[model samples]
Every structure is written in C-alpha cells, then in structure tokens.
Target chain A: MMGKHAQNRILAYSTPLVLIGILLVFVAAITLTGDKALGRMAAETLIRVVLVVGLWIFVGNSGVVSFGHAGYMAIGAYCSAWLTLKPQMKSLFLPDLPSWLAQAEWPVLPAAVASGLLAAFVALVSGATILRLSGIAASIATFAFLAIVNTVYSNWEGVTGATSSLVGLARYVDQWVALGWAAAAIIAANLYANSASGLALRATREDEAAASASGINMYRHRLLSLVVSGFFTGVSGALLGHSIGVLNPDSFYLGITFISLAMLVVGGIGSLSGAVVGVLSLSMMIEALVRFEQGISIGETQLALPSGAQEILIGIVMILVLILRPSGLMAGKELRMPRFAPRSPDYKTSNN
Target chain B: MTSLAQLFFDAASLGGIYAMAALGIALIFGVMNLVNFAHGEYIAFCVFALIVPSTEAVAVMFLGKAPAFLLIPVLLGLGAGAAVASEYVVFRHMRKATPVAMMISSFALGFVIQNALLAVYGGRPKAISLWPDLNTPVGVLGAQVPLLQLIVVLTTLLVVCALALLLKKTRLGLEMRAAAENFTMARLLGVRANVVITGAFALSGALAAAVALIMATQTGVADVRMGGQIMLVAFIATVIGGLGSLPGAVAAGFLIGGASVLLQAFLPLEVRPFRDAFLYTLVIACLLLRPQGLFAASSAKPRI
Candidate 1:
C-alpha cells in the first residue's frame, strides 16, 4: 500500500528502531522483575551495549580493530569522577588536583557529557597520527595509545588515585538510565553508518587503494569515526563508573578491551544490530554463568561451577563461536523485517 | 663510570629477554600471519611448570628441583609441546578464517589458559627461587654485574647465532623462509604446510620457554600475570621491527628494552613512574614515522 521509497525509508530506520525496542523490552522485563540484582545486570549489560556500539562506529565501518577504546573509557570515567564527586571528598582523596578542578563540582549529566567531549578530544589528537597507518599497524598503535593511557593513569597519583580504586561516585546509572544511553548509542551508530564519512570509511575498509583512488580521504574519515567512537566509549566509561560507583585504571585495561572486542566480534562486527545483540547475548551468558557459579538448585542438591569456571567456559565458547562463524552470528547483516517477495533487480541495495 | 657500566649491563639483560620474546612472536606471525596472544600464556605455563601447583606464598619446587642440564631441555620441550598442541587444537582449523577472527580466537585461547592457571594455581604471586646463586654480583669493568644477567646475555647471543645457522642452513628453514615470504606460493611450490607451521610453533614455543626461564630467574617471583607485561612489550617490538622480519624483531626488542631502561635511569624521580607512558608514546611516534616498520620485509608491502 505504500510507495517503495517510503518502504525503503522505513526499512532504513527499522534496524535502529528494532534495536532500541529490544533494549526497551529488556529494561521493561527487568523493571517488572523488580529485583535489584536483575536491575544491576540489565544496567551493566546496557552500558556494555554503549561501549561495544561505540567501538563498532569506528571498527565496524573502518575495519580497524581497536584495542584502545578502553583508554577513552578510562579518560571519560576519571573525568566524570573528577567532576561529579563531592568537592570535599575530592579534596580529601585527590588533594593534588588543581584549584579549579579541586573546588568545582557539576551535575551528573553535564559531567558525563564533558567526559565524552574530553575523550573525543583525545581521540582526535591520537587518531590524527594513528589513522595514517593502515591495517594491523593501526591496531598496534591504538594498543600503544592504550598502554600510554594506562601507564599515565596508574602513575598519576593526584588525579586518578594512582592504581587505587576511586570510590563514592554517584551511582545514577540504573537500568532505565542505561536503557536511554544504549538507545542513544544505537541511534548514533545507525546514523554514522549511513553518513557520508562512515560510508567513505567503509569504502576504505573494503579496499584502501580503490577507496583512495576514488578520492576518499581515508585519514579524515577514519579520524571522524574514531572521535565519534571515542565519545561514546567515554560516555560508557562514565556510565560504568557511576554504575559500580568505583573507578580503577586496571578495570579499563586489557580485560575490558578484549572482552568488549569479543562481544563485538561475536555479535557481528559490521552491523549496528550486531553490536547491540552481541552485548545483550554475551552479557546474559556471563550473568547466567555467574549465577551458576553461585550454585544452581538441582532436584537433589545444589550444583555449582568452580569460581573461575565461568571465565574458562566463556573463553571456550568464544573460540567455538569464532570457529563456527568467522564473520560472527549476524554475519554483517542488520536485523530486518522478513520480506515475502524477491526484490526487483532495479531496486537499490538496501543500507545494511 | 661504574654506574654507567652497571646501567649498560642492566639494559642488555632486559633487552636480551625481550629479544627472545619478540623472536618467539615474530616466528609465529611470519608463518601464520596470526599474532598469537596466547604466547604470553605459554610463557606463564612454562614458569608455572617449574613449580608445584599451590596457592601458598612460597612455591614448592617441582621441576625447579631438577638439575640444570635436565631442567632446561625439559622446560623447553614442554613449551614446544604446548605450542604445537594449541596449533593442532585451535589454530589449525582457523587457517581459512580472517586475521581478525584468528586474533580473537588467540585472545580467547589465552583467556582460557590464564583462567585455567588461575583456577589451579590460585591468584597469589609465589616466590620462586630458581638459582639464587645466579644473582650473586661479580665486578666487571669497575661495575658489579649479576651472574644471571651475564648468563642471560650470553644465552641470548647463543640462541641468536644458533637460530641464524638453522635458518640459513636447514631445509626446514628454507621452507619457513619461503612460507614467510609468500604462503600460497610456498604451498604451490610443494612446501608441506603442516610441517612448516608446526616447526615454527615449536621454535616459537622454545623461545617463550627461554624467556620464562630468564624471567623466573631474574624476578624470583612467579605470578599468573607475569607474562602479560613482557608479552605486550614483545608484541610492540615485533610490530616495530616489521611484522615478519626476525632480525628486525630482535633489534627492536633490544631498542625498546634499552630505551625503557635508559628512561628509567635518566628521567627525574618525579617522572620516573611515568617511564612506561613515555616509552609507549615513543612507540606511537615510531609507528607514525614508519608505518611499515623500521625493517620491513618485501612481503609486508601491499601489492596494490
């Protein structure tokens, strides 16, 4: 009954809408349960959605695997901690902070925004040089960037508490708030994937020589994607900090980096839907594993996995998944409504 | 002047360890184009192999009690065995997958290995006394140098020379070199893919074992997480040396090690704690200056 263009437009928007809808339903389910632990799990899962989707903005489009987005998250997290913690608490804990940062305090939302902006600024600076290199070289450079960030943060006594955990952060990121951010991240990732810069970056990812030959500025587009990616990654860091109400440099190091990357790869590294789905599925599995580790009620007795069994099992599962589906579960395809008829040959390829 | 000599010995010893680690990584990457993240776990496994599995602060010697003549070869064999087993179990099936997938798999494999070790050994760092006598300092050029450090340098030199000879003179080496240059072409030329791949894994694993021995002797402490920092530095060296270039990997390993030591020694006390930050920044700068690496192999260049 509708024109083809209208249908196409709806289809284009449907992926993000479906993703957001899925998140909303997850949040509703958690809310209905009214259990604090379930609420915490949902919130953590949504935060990971933000982190992975942020990572996908650059990695999915540019085909550059980053081992450093966690660095941006660290930057955002500490930035929020510096801005939002009580002035009195900051003075006692981080006495070496400059007078301005020492005395100033801001609301949670603005502090998070500022944290994201700060992370974006760092990405812009670092990516300017890093994006010049292509492929694995770029990946290594991002890793170096992460190392630099970690080393600095771990040693910076006055600001980051120097390897000590910074506590007393406002735990404002409940499931609903996290749901809002996750939806925002999905929408942003969807927009970027369809944008000109994103398309150009994807072109380079497909074939750098051909993309350059076609006049795409690989450096600029890559940088833009990285900056946007850095922003959301930073916001996620802030969310993680607020959710747990603690911050540590070690938390944002290789563990989060690899785990988040694993989620992205498992979900399908190429599509927005993959990013969201990857986070949800992997997070749920992890939660279930944790519960099992705690002890499952069997008919006769409680059966519990060993304490570290979850990590080992998850790793094995990841390997099996990669072996079975190299391109990931979504295989780079966005979630879409089922189509009944074959498309006409003249129809333009739908944006994935 | 004595202090300067001491610094040189310190740098060289660290550099030697890093060189071995880098070579291990470079060998695998040359053959398979896979940056085996599990390489670090291999090192940890070898170190852990030297001790009885326990959560106690003081490690009970298992293999560490073996005589030097028997211990070295056994540990090296264990490293090689583990590497080859992983190749057969996990990596062999992934030959057709993209580099990214293989990389993630390697990381997952590492995660599994690390956690398995954690579950068995527990998380506490154990004091491991390998050869306490090796730490005795002897005067050299007016500077006292540890015997272990001198041995590390000599062992690194010996390994490099031996590997050079093997690579230049052996048939397996020729096949490996060919494969590193062009894997498909080497296959077409009748190179046995399994043999060459398995060989590289073996050599790489032995090198990891050597690094583990050196670290265990040097630090006198075996932690589950010990291999991670060295592995990261070695990975960066491997890239900086040119992804597939063996000699370059060794050189960059030494360079990074020397740079790190020098930075630690020369930087002001206030900035000393940030030495790794400075080192990594330099790594980024080096990468930016030469994206193809300081010693790029011909195969590293894109045909397009």
Candidate 2:
C-alpha cells in the first residue's frame, strides 16, 4: 500500500486529471453530435472556461475580487488584432498606428501568444501599483483601471476605430483551438494553485498579519498571480475575438466582467475545480434556458418560455445558490475519484 | 470669465448628482460591509417606474402625468420600496456570507433588475419630456445657466443639510451611525441591526430616486443604461472619499465632477475625447498617494 503522504499527493494531483477528462468528454460529445450550432456553443463555453480559469488563478488564490481582468482581456484582443490583421486592414481602419504596426502581420498562434505576453506585461506594471491596495480599496482601484482602459479604447478613434466593431479578422478559433487554450489554462491554474507563491498568497488571504510575520511578501505574490492570471485572460480574449471574427470594446466591458465573476463565484472561488465546474454548470444552464426560450419541441408541440426569462432565471439561481451555499457549489474543494472503499467521504467545505 | 463661470455651473450641477449617488452608496457600505452594486439599478428602476411597463418605442407616462408634488414622493417611494425589498429578499439572508459573496449577490440582483427592465422596456432609449420649463436657460453671474442646473445644486444642498440633521438629531440616525462605526459594539449597546440596516436602505433608495428625477428632467431620456455611468463614478467617489465617511464621499464626488469638467474644457480637440482616461489616471495617482483615501476616518487606518 502507498504511504499516507503519497496517497495525499495523488489526491492533490487528481484535479487536473479530472478536469482534462471533463474537457475530453465535452469534445467527444460535440464531435459525436456533429451539430454546427452545438459546436459553436461548445466553443463559446470553452472560451469562457479559459477566461474564468484565468480569473481563478488570481482571485481564487489571493481571495481578492478583481473587476479589472476584463481590461487585460481587452488589451490582449486589441493587441492580437494589431498583429494578426492584414496590414491593409490596419492601415485602413487603425490609421493612427505607428508605421511598423500599421504594416505588421503575423501568424495566428504567435499573435495570440504575443497578446498574452502584452497583457502580462501590462499587468506587471499596473499590479506593482494596484497590489499596494488591500481589501475593498484594491477592488475599486482595479475597477478604475477597467474604466480607464474602456474610456481610452472607446474614444481613441484613430487607433481603435473608436466604439465601432473592428472586423475582417480570420475566424481561426474553433472548438478545438478554444479547447486547447482552456486545457492549458486549467493546467496552468492547477499548477499555480499548488505552487509556493500560490500558497503564500493564500496564506495572506487567510491572515495578512500572520503571513507577513512569516516573511511572505504579500505584494510580490499578489503581483505574480495577477500577471499569470492576466496572461490566460488575454489568451481567452484573443480566442473570443477570433471566434466572433470581430472585436468591440463594449463586449469586453461590464457585461463580461460581472458574468465572469459570477461563474467564478458560483463554482467555488477558492479552488481550480470550482472555477471549472462553475463555468460548466452555469454555461449549461444558460444554454438550456436559451434553448427553451427558442421554443423546444416536446412531442411535436412547441413550447417556449419568455425571451428574457433566461437572464432572470440565472440571476435567481445564482442568488439562491449563494443563500443556500455561500461558499459556492463546489465549496472550494477539488474533484477526486471515488475511494475504493468509501468510509463516509469527508472533504473540507470552506477555505477558512 | 464667462466661460469659467459656465464651467463652474456645469461642474457643480454634475457634482451634485454624483454626490447624491455617492452618499447613497456610502450609507449602505457604512452600515453593512457590502458595497451595494445594485444601487445603480435602483436609479434605473425608479426612472422606469415613471412610465408604464411596455415594449413600445414611445413610452406612455404612468407617473409623469401626476403633479410634481405628488410625482416626486411617489417616485421616491418606489425607489425605497425596491431597495428595502431587495435587502429583505437577498441581503437579509446573506448576513453570514463573506463580503465577496455578498458583493457578487448584489451584482446578481442588479443583473436581474436590469434584465427585467430590458424585457419590459425593450433595448431602446426612450425620450420623456418631463418639466420642459426647467430646460430654459437663466442668466447667472454673467453666464447662461439652465434652470435645472440651479435646481440640482439647490436640491443637493437641501438634501445634504437634511441628511446631516437626520444623522445628528434623529434616534434612527444615531443608531445607524453607531452601527456604521462598529456593528458589534453598537449591537452590544442595544442597537437593533435590522431596523438600522432597513433605514439605511430606505434612505439610500430615496436618494437614488432623487437622482433619477433630476437625471430624467435634465437629460429628457429614460434609458436603462443611463444610471450605469453615474453609479460607477459614485462608487469611485465613495472609495476616494474614504470608506464609511459620508462627508468625504460627497467631497470626492464633487472633486471628480470638477476635474472631469476641467479636463473637457482644457484638453485640445484630439485629446478631449479621452477625458475619462485622464480622469481615471488622476484617480490612480490619488489612490497611490493616499490609499487610505483623501479623507480617511480614524477607523479606516490599517490595523496591525
């Protein structure tokens, strides 16, 4: 029999394995169905998984609610457009770009990676200043950062095309591409959640004074997590832009911010499994509600709920979940295989 | 000199609205640890209440037909009722949850309210001409000022004075203040947490209604998105003014409004469009300089 420590290590590493299994099953299911619309839906859900998992990398570990990750996503999406769009498209639409950027063109993968790097660079610069703030003040400062990014993007007409959707990009991100990035994000988040810096960040999240006394630099760990988080968030944004083949500053604003946060909180803001499960469960619910709104057929009789009931129902569901299980659906616990001989399963329910 | 005077009037008018909103947010945050993100929806809901719920392009006024005296109170009541009901329905049950959880729930409530309005009103921005006479410009100190601008300034002043009185003299206000200062200590001293929290929500809601009335009258539009911008600025103001500090919140609100106006007036045409960016950059600078806020209450100091 394996020793207790080895058994614990196996259990700890089971999360990513379980997550990979879920992704593979989802991919297989989509392939088996061979429905174009279902493929598109799966692509969107996978992209959301990327974004939410990226969010979990920071918020889950640090226990800080960031209203700013969307800003980084915007930066990444625009950067990707700048790199991957045809030189003619850039010169024609984004006329204010410098000569080099106006004439630049790159492959899709390189552009996406560059976009993530650009977002991480921005995150590093901003996090140095922003991470100084703690608690609600830090959250508000991040929000201010979002507002700044949005205002600049919306009004910089020459550079960004100013509030209008930038189009004509190749729609290169399909289900498989999005799934690849989503899996990468899941693995990265899982690895970081078990890393030394991640542990230190969590310690600060639990008790700042104690963490500091123990020589943990709260600011440094926080900034590190934020940079990592920003990188994946940026990639997700690139995938979204490519999926839609258009980029709009409005799409990366308040609507996505709240929804992404909702998914993270609903799943379990403290664990990798929570982030994945939250996105999966809520995305399915939203899809189901959307289908019902589109008049689902039952025994040849068409039935449809109200057009906007999906949004209302989701809100109600989220609220009910919070009231009933404030820690979230997963309650900050990771996924693991069933024991060979179950002796009344026990798992930690809350991070604290 | 005339342009300067005009700028001042514009700043003060905008600032007044922001101050009211900041006060509303600060009140809730003071009493409860939660920063009520749904306060914006309260303003939206109040404006929508003025018209009959329908999907038509042109909105028929349900409350707009009422006399001003009657209309104001009714709108205020609607805002208060919605706010209090939300607190009871959602927040009351979330007392034991973490602040982050509560904050997300508030966001969910806002989402529900916004989508409900969207369903009933459709996604169109409707124009409602309420009190057209208020739109007329009046000469003030060599500058042409709209009557609505003057009214907004005066109303803000009156509301502030009334709020000060309530906080200082009323028993309910005293309990709220005590609760805001320290909830556990206040409860130990016989303060009823529920009553104080309900009172704060009611006041906050009424203030939202007030801002809604002024906004509807000034802009002559009742779009679902109208309140979002102001709410965001107010939230920023609430933080920059220092948490749990009402006067600080009001002052910060006015300062932001003033800075925004100044930037608009002075920036060259090319840069004028990025006024918000510059304003937010200034906000980041302010936060870096004083993370505790410009007017930090003693309690706001970091505890070892």
True-vs-predicted CA distance for residue B59, candidate 1, Å: 1.0
- lDDT (10s digit) by residue, model 1, range A108-223: 99999999999999999999888888899899999999999999999999888999889999999999898888888889988888888988989999999999999999999999
Residue A146 miss distance in model 1 (angstroms): 0.7
Candidate 1 Cα deviation (angstroms), residue A139:
0.9
Q: In candidate 1, what are the lDDT values of residues B75-172, reduced to their tens digit? A: 99999999999999999999999999999999999999999999999999999999899999999998999999999999999999999888999999
- Using Cα atoms, each model's DockQ against the true complex is 0.92, 0.82
Model 2 alpha-carbon drift over 4 Å, by segment: A1-3, A337-352, B302-304
Against the true structure, whose TM-score is highest?
Answer: 1
Question: What is the fnat score of candidate 1?
Answer: 0.94
User: Each prediction's Cα lDDT score?
Assistant: 0.93, 0.91
Which stretches of model 1 miss by more than 4 angstroms? A1-10, A338-352
Q: Give the Cα-based TM-score of candidate 2 against the true structure.
A: 0.97
Ten contiguous residues minimizing lDDT sum, candidate 1 chain B: B1-10
Please write out the lDDT profile of model 2 over residues B1-304, one tens digit for every residue.
4487899999999999999999999999899888999999999999999898898889889998899999999999989999999999999999899999999999999999999999989989998888989989999998899999999999999999999999999999999989988888999999999999999999999999999999999998989988788889999999999988999989999999999989988899888878898998888889888888878777767678
